[model samples]
Structure formats: structure tokens, C-alpha cells
Target chain A: MKNNEITDITPKRRLFELNLGDVWKYRDLVMLFVKRDFKNSYKQTVLGPLWIIIKPFLSTFVFTVIFGMIANISTDGMPQFLFFMAGNILWSFFSSCLNGSSSTFIGNARLFGKVYFPRLVMPCANIIYNTIGFLINFVMFFILVLIYMFTGSNVHPNLCALLMPFILLSSALLGTGCGLIVSSVTTKYRDLGVLVSFGVTLWMYITPVVYPVSQVAEPFRPLALLNPVAPLIETFRYGFLGSGTFPWQYLILSFVVTAVVLVFGIIVFNKVEKNFIDTV
Target chain B: MREMNENCVIKIENLSKEYRLGAIGSGTLRHDLQSWYAKKRGKEDPNQRIGAKQYTKGDTFLALDGVNLEVNRGERIGIIGTNGAGKSTLLKVLCRITAPTDGRVRFRGRIASMLEVGTGFHAELTGRENIYLNGAILGMTKEEVTSKIDSIIEFSECEKFIDTPVKRYSSGMFVKLAFAVAAHLDAEIMIMDEVLAVGDMRFQKKCIKKMRDLATEEDRTILYVSHNMNTIRDLCDRCIVLDHGKIVFDGDVEDAIKIYLGSANENFRALEYVGNEHKHHADRNDLCLQFVRYNGKEDSNLSKKSYHCG
Candidate 1:
């Protein structure tokens, strides 16, 4: 009902008035952003959205060769191609969220300086756009899953597979939450920008992407498990490949960490949004 | 209280915005921490943050200070100021793009602004797509934009290139589309800032006429900022002249313009006098140098004289 009663804007607003309700009113803007992101990212490229699948496939090929053949990384008895494909696809989804949203403020300084809307929409749209790429890349994933099944391999996608979307959502939320914090920080200290992109690469190494949790020894093993993304990726592998551990406790832990991180990101982001135009 | 009549759509009271000049913040984390520590210790902020200092020297400034204004529905108010007079800053605060450092801005109805042309326009998106995107950014729903799509294209005069990516369009074509989209926003209050400077004279006239219609027929409130006095005088019924972020004059368009134009000539005269500033106290050699060997005159005929102008 307050929608129609004049907006009173003051210098000192409540720090935590997330105003998600206002975001829903601008749903059309978010859709346009999704559309714009797709158009801009895919446009002019010769292959268009085909680049979505091609990118993951090429990376998977490289990852499988280097980690599986050269270094002989473990895939938990699953085919190297299928395992790397899943890992690359899922890891990309999470990293893209981080990489994309982390620069949301710096990348959008011009647009943000001119207009007003829920600042969250920019990062939210990033996740959605990346999801589009992930889904297209999902086709490559599905085909690989089918290929292993037809060959009578040990790729048994189980009922746990139903949880894949939810797990991916959690990873996206976790990445976006962390990305929001980084985005706000980078606006002040640009050094973080360089650190984050580099950190993400190091992050993928520790998340058991190229190897399985079972292959890591005890001390390093627990460290990998402590990575918030580790359990989600493990759950994803368990769901889609039926070979990884699935402790509900870890999943619950991942969910809680994601919830906390997202709330913190929003709080920091909300504070940054008010005066960022000055410092940014 | 009278300004709060149902007819009034906007009220800005005791509005002030302070900005630290040289480099925003303390330029480094140590200084930022020092500023925080200053606040904690109940000491004067070493950062000298907030509060507008006179422009005579240093970086701190007030973009707006204790400014108060009210506009009734259907009023077209022109805001004119020299660069950095806070015209754009006030509009930015009005649009909620940036929060004011102090005071409040009250808006009775939805407001859409053209802070700049092609604000969110991406080069890769087609002109048609940008129309929807821009409209949505202005807070229009899909159904509303779809309904106006045809008219928008016609108004922009980019019918043939509607499907083509905007990157290929000339700057003029882009502004036309952007202005057309802004024109279609049905909000009760509209704010514009120097965006009309784009495009040709004929299109500018068209836009002025449309703005007239919007104010008169549509019963909308308009706040416009422009350096073009002709557009301001021709379109706005009232004017506010801003000098160093404060409204020096707020009244009838012609009178406010007279004050604005008067100050401008004063500034020009002041600048003209600035050329003589160094001469008033020039070093002896800089005072007057008469070139030698001109017209076969010998070097011995050269003259160097010093005379203080003041």
C-alpha cells in the first residue's frame, strides 16, 4: 500500500531495508537485463550461443587430458571425460557467478550513476545469465552422461540427481553472495579485483574438481571438505554420477553458509549502493 | 505546509550534499582508518569530511546546502547553472541515483528522468531491443512498453533501423530513440538533465513542443536542467538559477534568466580582467619589453621598463 504514497529519500536510510519488494516491481528491467546480457555476450561471435557448449567442451577436453592422462587425477571410477565435463561445467557456473558479479559495481559505474533501481538486480541478473550458459552447457553434460550409460560404464545417475538444480542454485547463491562482497570491496580497493580472479582459479584446484574427495589424503582431505563449494560439488557429482559421498550434514552446512554469506553480501551491498557513486 | 497541497508533486527541504574534492575518501586505508579513529575519539575529523567549505580554496564543497523548493503538478521548472553549480547533482538526487548528504527529497508520484541520453543503451542490442530495455529501466512494464512500441519507433524516426543494432546508428538516431522512450514514460513527474543537447535543431524543436504538450495537456510536473537559455525560457514557466550549488534566484523564468545572464556577463568581465592580473605585479623584466632590431633599430635602442598597473 505504501507503493503509491510518495517516496521520501533521505541521506540516512535504514541499513537493512533490502526493498526486495521494489525489485519485483522492476521485474521487467531484470528481464531486459537478462535479454541484454544474452544478446551482448552472444552477439557478433561467429558461433553465438553455440559458444556456450563449445567453451565447456573445449575446457573439459583440456582438463581431462592434463589432469587425467598427464597427472593421472582420480575421477572416482567414472570415465575421465564425463567426470571432467561435469566438473568443468559446474565449476564454471560457480566461477562465472563470482567473476561476473564481483565487478558489478565497477562494470556498471556509468549505468549506476545515471539511473536508480534495486542494485541487487545487476548481480542477480549475472547469475541468471550464467545459468543460461550452464543450461546450454548442460546439453553437453547430458550427452556425456548418455554416452557413458550406453557403453555400460559405471555412470549411474541416481535419484539424488533430482537435487542437482537445488545444488546448483546454492552454489550460485554462494558465489553471488561472495561476489557482492567483493564487488563492494573492489569499489574501494581495486587490488581485490586482481586477487579474486586469481583466487578463483586457486579455488577450483582446492574444490576437488580435477580429483575426487576420496583420492585426497587425510589432512588435505578435511581442508577440501571445508571449502563451502566442496560439498555442493560433491553433492552434484553424487547426484549426476552416483559415485561421490552425500552426507546430508554437509549439504545442510553448505546451505547455512550460503544463507549467511548472502545476507552479509546484501548488507554490505546495500551500504555501498548509497554512496558508491562518490567513491566509485 | 502550503507547498504540500495535493497539487504539489515534489518538495525538497533543507537539502545538502557535501563532497570531498582532491580524491574521494582519504585516498588510502590508513587515512580512512584515521578518519574512523577521529570519529571514535570525539575529535575533529582530520579528513575534514562533510560540510561545504567555501570554493576559495581546497577540495570540500557543498553540492546543495539547506536548499528548499516545491513544485506543483503541471509546472515546468527550469534549472540553470554554470558547470559544477550542482544542477546535475540535484537532478541525480531527485532521481534517487545518489543519496543527498543531508535533508530530504519528497516525491508524490513516480518520476522518470533522462539524466543522459543512451544511459543503459548497449551497442550490441538492436534499436528495438533498446527501446524495451530503456523503457523497462524507466519502470515501465512489458505490456505498457509493447503497447507503445509502434508509436515509439515512429516517434524516434528510426523505423527502418529498428531491428538493426544501435551501435551502427548515428549518435543522432540513438538520441532520438532514447528521447522517444523517455517521452513515453507516463509518470506524473519527469526530470531531464542536459540530454536535449544531442541531435539537430529540428529534433530539438520537436522535443520542446512535446514537452510543452506533456506539461500542459498531460498535467505532469517537469524539472529540467539545461545550459540552453532559449530552451529554458521557451519551455519552462519558472526558473531556478544555481550558483556554487545554491539557488541564487527562484522565480519567473524571465527574471531568473536575467539574474543568470547578468552573472554570466559579470563572469565574462571578470575573466577579461584576469588577463591583467599578472601585469599588476609583474617582475621588472616582465613589466614591459620593447623588442630591439625592429625596423633596423639597433639592440641598444631596446627598452625594458617596469610599472605597476594597480
Candidate 2:
């Protein structure tokens, strides 16, 4: 035992005493997990990471067929490919955050069961990995933006486009916050793990991924705005596609909700991780 | 200097861990709701069973019940016990991998543990990558692992295959690589559980020597758990025996081993008649019932017959 070192292993109960120091100390571990995610994700695939590029277009094809031509939903004035692809990219960023971070407890149970570090590192790593994915998807989305501009379509990007980084960060935060809570609760109720995947799909429909939030009729708009995810998607569409509304109140409200949920997620995650090995 | 109690660092106070008997959340929602209601009423947990003695099949099992121990710096304590004796559970609680259901532990140190072979190894990752990943998982910084990566690979004797994915490595090679990282992990308190079991004879001797050096030369406190009495005796100056989630003996190393070995046979005899607690070996019917005819002759009557081994 060292003279300066002191550790107390108690039944920890204090909420929101998030240990930032340990998380900062284990930044290398976060990076390792991020690296592992990239390696493991496309390990056996012939295309390796290039599959990520093919993925967006494939999903955009499905969305265009289902939501654009088949269902005849309006994309305001922008081209359908541009609109659907933009939504596809943002949705990918959003869902990846949820899918990656929320399963942190259950997915990494073996590793977590044997070692002790800040439990937050696992989810944080997933967010970082998802952020990298978002950036890649953004680059792909940027190419489509250029093609539309060269063809002389009115694909005007507003000043709000500069808020792309903040929008993506908030989206990642929201997904991670929600995922952490689900992952924490999953130790006790494994049904939540099943529900998370199904729920995120339903969550995407309400977030204006397939259609504009303005497409929803008058009485349901406030209900859709209450989702927090809707406002970010709307702001993102407004910034990039130049064809949607950016309600500042809803944006602040989403930020507040994300902050609160992230705090709660950290609290519950910290609580469950310490003894999850026994239950797990 | 260790004789004086002032160097004491780890002080455990009535540490306990309770495990639910069945299901992920302990059976149906009704049970969980009932537990919640009980806690809400400021009453004892409805499923809380006092388990200082032994565990019976129940709605909950007490894996550890009020364990208390103290150790000074640099003491290599051997934890020995039979299956379900809470040996691994005790180590898990100390490593903070699992929280105790009750009580607290106070220690001064950065604790590093290798509880199982290849604990955090990913099969798809190369040996070099796994080293950095596993070392980081064990709380070592990346630079620390980077600085020692060469030595770790050399120690594992897997130099030619360091860049190959761990899945291609044989089981023995995997364990060696895992153990190499664990051994090099820097910490004030080190824990190892049966790490020497999988190694070859010569490698086992080398690991033992390394463990001895970690304890004596580096002055790191170690808590080693193993069923092999010889290694325990060789490595530990003191030992603690746990039986049924409670420490039955804590004393001189040899005495603890003797008590542990003796009680195991004592328990075998005790289990001959589960319902009746006090049947003597001679009075017990199971002894002579071995060769008794199934023609309804009383086992007691068969006690007069002689039996010979095959």
C-alpha cells in the first residue's frame, strides 16, 4: 500500500458524485475501447470500414422508396435524395449513439466483472466511437450536398449549418444518456435490453427521420416536440437542407433534458456497475 | 517491522455480500415489488436470511457474511477454502469488482488484480493490442503499457507472434500472454487467483519466483487465492481459511492448512446423514449399505457383513 493512496470500498449511495478524475485518468482505456469497436465491428467483412459508406446509401435507398416515392411525403422543396440522405446520416449518428452506449453494461460485463476503473469510461468510449462514425457519415453527407450544389438546385445551407458540431454532440449526448440509463437498468430487468432496440426504432419515427416534423398535423406537433429528439433533427434539417424550422425553446429544452438524463444515467450506471457482477 | 500493527493498511469491517437465489432480478416482479415495499417500510429486507453458519437452498444466498480481516503492508495472505466457501467472492469484493452487501473496506493503495486468465482479452485483437487494452483495463496508463510492451512480450515468450490476433494463439500461449501483462501491472496492492495453475512446470516455478519477488522485494501487499496447498504454503507467510462464507481459521500458514484439510473430511462425514446431524460413522447405515441387497433387508442389518474393495 502506498502512503498517499486511500481507497474505500463501501456500498456506494451518493448520487451524482460522478468521478471525473478516474474517467480522465482512464482516457487511454476509452480510446482502446473505441479502437476495439472499430476493429471488432468490421473484422470479418471484405470491405472492412468501407462498409460504413455503403451502409448510408443502402438505408437511404430504403427510406427513399418507403417514405419518399412510395408514401409521397413532402421534403419541403429540396431533392428527395438530399433530404432522405441527410436524415439517414443524422439518424445513423443518433441510433449509433443509443445502440453503442446503452449496451455498455451488458456487452462489456465480462471485462467490467474483472476490473475496476471508472464505469463511465465504457459508455464514453461508445460515444466517442459513434462520434467518429458520425463524422464519417457527415463526410458522406457532405458529398451529396456538393453534388446538389453543382447541379444548380436551390440547396441553400443556412447560417445555422455552423451548429452542426453542437447538434451532433447533443445527439450523441442524448443517445448516450438514454443508453446508459437503459444499460444500468438492464442488470435488473434484462427485458429492457430487448426493448431498447425496438424502442430506438420507434424513437426514430417520431424524430422526423423519414419525414419533416412539420408533416405532422397541428394537434400532434407539441407531442412530437416533447420528444427532445425531434427538435435536434428539425434544427439539423434546417441547417443542412434549409427547409425546416429551428424552435429555440425546444432546442434548449432538449439540451436540458439531455443534461438531466446524462446526469441520471451516470448516477444509475455508477450505482449498478459496482455490484452488477454478482447479479450478472 | 511487520510485527508491529502500525503498518496495517487494509481494515475490513463486517463485509458481507448477499446473492439472490434465482432469476436475473431474483424471480418474478412480485418478489422485487415485495422487496421494494419492505425497504420502503423501513423494515429489514424480507428476503434477508441470517447466514453466519451455512447456506441452505433459499430465495437468497449469503455469499459472504460479516467477513473481517486486517493486514499490514507487504503481507502475502493466502485465502483457501472449498467450493462455495466465498473464497472467490471475498477476492471479488476486495477488488471492488462486486460490492459487498454490507460493511466497508478501508485500504491505502492502488489495487490491481488478475482474477482469471485472460480476463479482458478480445479474440479479434492482436497480442500487442490486447496487452495495451488489458493493461489499461487493469488501470495502467497507455504510456506505461507502451514502455513495458516489449518486456511483456518477451516475458510471455510470444515475440514472433506479438502482432497476430489472440484467437490464433494456443490456449497455453494465451494464458502466458495474459499472465505476462498481469504480472507487469504496477500497483501498491496486487492480487492473483490461481494464475500459476495453467503454466508449465518451469513456467510455474518462474511465476512463483516472480510472485515472491513482488511480495518481498517490491514490498507490495498481495492476496493470493489458490487450492494448491503447496504453492500457498510456499508463497504465503500467513493464511486464512474460509468455510461456508465465513472465516473458520486465520493463523499461522501451516496451521490454517491443517485445519482446512481436516475440516473437509469432517464435513464429508457430517453429510452422510443430512437430516440427522449427529450420526457416528459406525452407526451410519451408508457405510454397510454399499453392498446390501435390494431385497428389502434393513441397511442396519447388513452392517454385520464384511466388505472388500475391488
Candidate 3:
């Protein structure tokens, strides 16, 4: 018998009580939530997962024509299609994760109100689900790269290509961290909910998703790297398409900033989870 | 550690939950900011009473007030109360679905709550998938649900449709499947809130029997909230009656029900006293509603306007 098991409920929980152990114990529930997301997201739809592929494909083509041709944005001397696809893959991954986690509380209020599992499970499940979506997008990008390579393109994926996993982890963390903070605040002041999607759209313009960081004026280049996601996308292009600079200091700063944002997000999220049922 | 009884499986002390009477945070950030600015300038909140402080009596609704309780192992406790009298709030706080505004609750073992059946079930998921999802939400691991899947399917008696989506199932079938999953929960403490209100009469009896066996054989502690006096009498060894966010009675089942109905009759009498001309009309209407709500079997007499029974 598990005599040592016990649980206490109180009006207030400590600020740092993240309950990571409970999240681990409820790992099955997290997986089930992820599976539910997968099943329900595409259910009864004819196109289904094809939408995942078509979305980025269409966006890539649009960016290639609009920015690459009309605006004459420098892709740092890379093919317009590949340049847009690489940036599209990383940006979409981070933004989707951010948008999804941003609505975690409001989206699952019914489930959270009736059950007692760790509240972190919802955000964690979303991060995993969005990661799966991100991976699919990445694979499509990779296949496009291979087709470009076979057709006599000058693209060369370097040793930096191995950093794909690390880049992905940091980006996911950053996105969910910011999303969690927004989710927590929206519990009380829902005005933020209306602004989240719009803010993410505006945020993309400043992060060099369509245009390379190299195109930024020299004076403002450093300022651009200060945005944590800037160096992530830059490094992603640097590795995969071999077109962008490898600023190691900016990448390190990006990771440190990601770690801090993620920690702060989780703390705020934990604080709100205790009583969010009232406000949400 | 606080002093706890060795046999007590659940303990709640000075528990209270207060909710703002109106929209949360005064409805908008603009109003919240206005209130904050007013407070900073040494003025009363513009959104609140002219001279009243925050959380004043009129500003908040006390859902549960200073409730203290303890339950030993293998006890089935029935909680009865009028709507908004805090029965559901008590179960919610105990389940940790919502935080209490004051005090604390401690439990000695694993607690599984069915605040509502099919709590996390997705409409698109099949009955089998929903069983797994619902079980996981109730704190069961994948292996635990896997082991009990067959028994759950058999208990629901919808084996043929187990693979079909729950959205396609009749409401009765859905409740049966959901209850079957909740019935198979492996926990030392179970908190249920009127989960058997749906489904056929035979199924409700079967569920009550299942809960009884769980309490007797497995020594699980159960805290059940229901308005049905018969079920309370049939299933509970102990009973609690709440009135206006306070525990008016807690004792043997028969005595608790007596106190509950006694007070209910008094409330009706008070209502009748407030209006003399419509006394007879109001009395019959209230009784008919109460009969239909609290006692389904007496619904046959709902048509009788002169029906008067205490």
C-alpha cells in the first residue's frame, strides 16, 4: 500500500511550486491530450494533414513572389523559393506553438474545471502537438531542399545542420514561454486574448522571417539580433540553406533569453492555475 | 505536520470560497485601471460601492463558509442542499478544481473525482478512446486503463458500439460508458457529484450497487452530492445537509433527511407568508417543482393542483 501518498489543497500555492513531478506522473494524460489533438484536428476533413503541407507551401510561394520579386528583398543570394521555405518553416513552428499555448486556459476551461490533474499538462501537451506539426513542416522543407539539390542548386547544408534539434527545442521553449505568460494574464484581463494573434503577426515582421537579417542596415543589425527569435531563424537559414551569418554570441543570447522567458512563463502559469477557474 | 487522525482519509478545515458577485475584475481592464487609479489617489474604487471596501458583504457571494469536515476510510457520505447552497462548491474545492478563498483540505490517499461524467471526452473520439481519455483525466495511467478497458466496456453494455464515436451514441449510452469508466477508477477516495442523474433506472441502481461494493470491499471513501433523497437514504451511511453555505445537519442518514425536509417546508411556508392572495397557487407550484426536481417517482401527481403532502 502507498501509505506515503497525500495531497493538500490551499487557497495559495508557493510561487515556485511548478509541480513538475505531477506533470511527469500525469505523462499519460499529456500523451492522451496530444493524441486527442491529433485525432480531432483532422477528423472528418477531406484534405486533412494535407492542409499542414499546403499551408506553408502556399505561404512560401506568396512570400517568394511578394518579397523576393516585388519588394526585391535580398535573400542573401539564395534561391527565393528555398529561402522563403526555410524561414517559413521555423517561423510558423514558433508562432503556431505560441498561439496554441497562448489560449491553453481558455481553450480547455471545461476540462480543467472538472478534473484535478496538473494544469501544466495542457501546455506541455500543446508544445508536443505543435512540435509534431513543426516536424512535418520541417520534413516538407527538407524534401524541397533535396529536390532543389538534385536540380543542380548550389545549396549546401553544413555541420551547422546538426543543430536542428537544439534550434527546435529552444524555439519551442521560447514560443510556449511567451504563450504561457499571455495565457496566465488573459485569465483576468481578456483584452490580451484579442491581441495575441495580431501581436504574433506583427512580431514576425521584426524577426526577419521573410527578409534576411543581412538586409538590415549595419547600425540596426545588432538591434535586430536582440529579438531572441531573430538569431534562431538566422541560424536556421545559416545551417540549412547556407545563406545567413553564424553569429554565435547572438545565438547564445537567444538561448539564455529563451530559458529565462520559459522559466518566468511556467512560474506565472503555476500561480494562475490555482485559481484561474474563478476568473476564466 | 498538522494533527491528523490515523484513520481519517480526508480533512477539510475552515474552508470557505467567496466569489465576486458580478463579472470578474469589474468586466474590463479599463474599469480595473480606473479603480486602481482611484485607489492610488486615496479615493474609493469607482467600480465598487461608494464607501464600501473591496470584498464587502454585498460584493461577494460566499459559496462555502467555514466548513470543517473529516472522513474516515470506507465511509460513503451524502451531501444534500438547495441550489447554490454550496454542495457543488464543496465537491469542487475538495477535488481541487477550484481554489478555496480560505483554509485548506488535506487527503491521505489518491483522490479521484467525477465532478461530471465524460469530463474530458471528445465527441470525435470513439467510446473506447473516450474510456482511455476519461480514465487518464481521472488520474489513471495508461496501463491501468488498458487493464480495465474490457471490464469497462462490458459494464457499459454498449460493447457493439465501443468502437463508434461517442457523438453518434444516444445520450443514455454516453452516460453509461462515462459512468462505467468512472466506476472502474482505482483510487482510495472518490468524489462524485450527481453522476447518476442520467441513464436508465436500472443503470442507476447498478451504479449505486457498484459504489456500495467499492466502499465495503475496497474500503474507498466516497463523498457524493445529490438532491435525490432516496439515493441518499439508500447509499449513504452518513449525510450532510447544507443551507445558505452552512452545514445545517450532519449525522445519521434518516435524521439528516428529516432536518433537510423540515427546513424545506419552513422555506415554503415563508414564501407563502410573503404573499397572501396567491398563497394557494404559489404553494402548489412550488411543491410541484420540488416534487419534480427532488422526487421523480411522485411526478405522476404533478397534475393535481390540490395535492398537499408533507
DockQ of 2: 0.53
Q: Weakest 10 consecutive residues, lDDT, candidate 3 chain A?
A: A1-10
Query: Distance from true position, residue A251, model 2, in Å?
Result: 1.2
Candidate 3 Cα misplacement greater than 4 A, ranges: A1-4, B43-58, B270-310
Q: Per-residue lDDT of B72-114 in model 3, one digit per residue for the tens?
A: 9999999986666799999889888889999999999888899
Candidate 1 regions exceeding 4 Å error are A1-4, B1-3, B26-59, B267-310
Model 3's chain A TM-score stands at: 0.96
Candidate with maximal TM-score:
3
Residues B51-75, candidate 1: write the lDDT tens digits: 8452333556798878889888899
Clashing pairs in 2: none
Can you tell me the CAPRI class of model 2?
A: medium
Report lDDT (Cα) of residue B197, candidate 2.
Answer: 69
Cα displacement (angstroms), candidate 1, residue A268, comes to: 0.8
Better structure of 1 and 3 per lDDT:
3
DockQ of each: 0.44, 0.53, 0.70
The CAPRI category of model 3 is medium
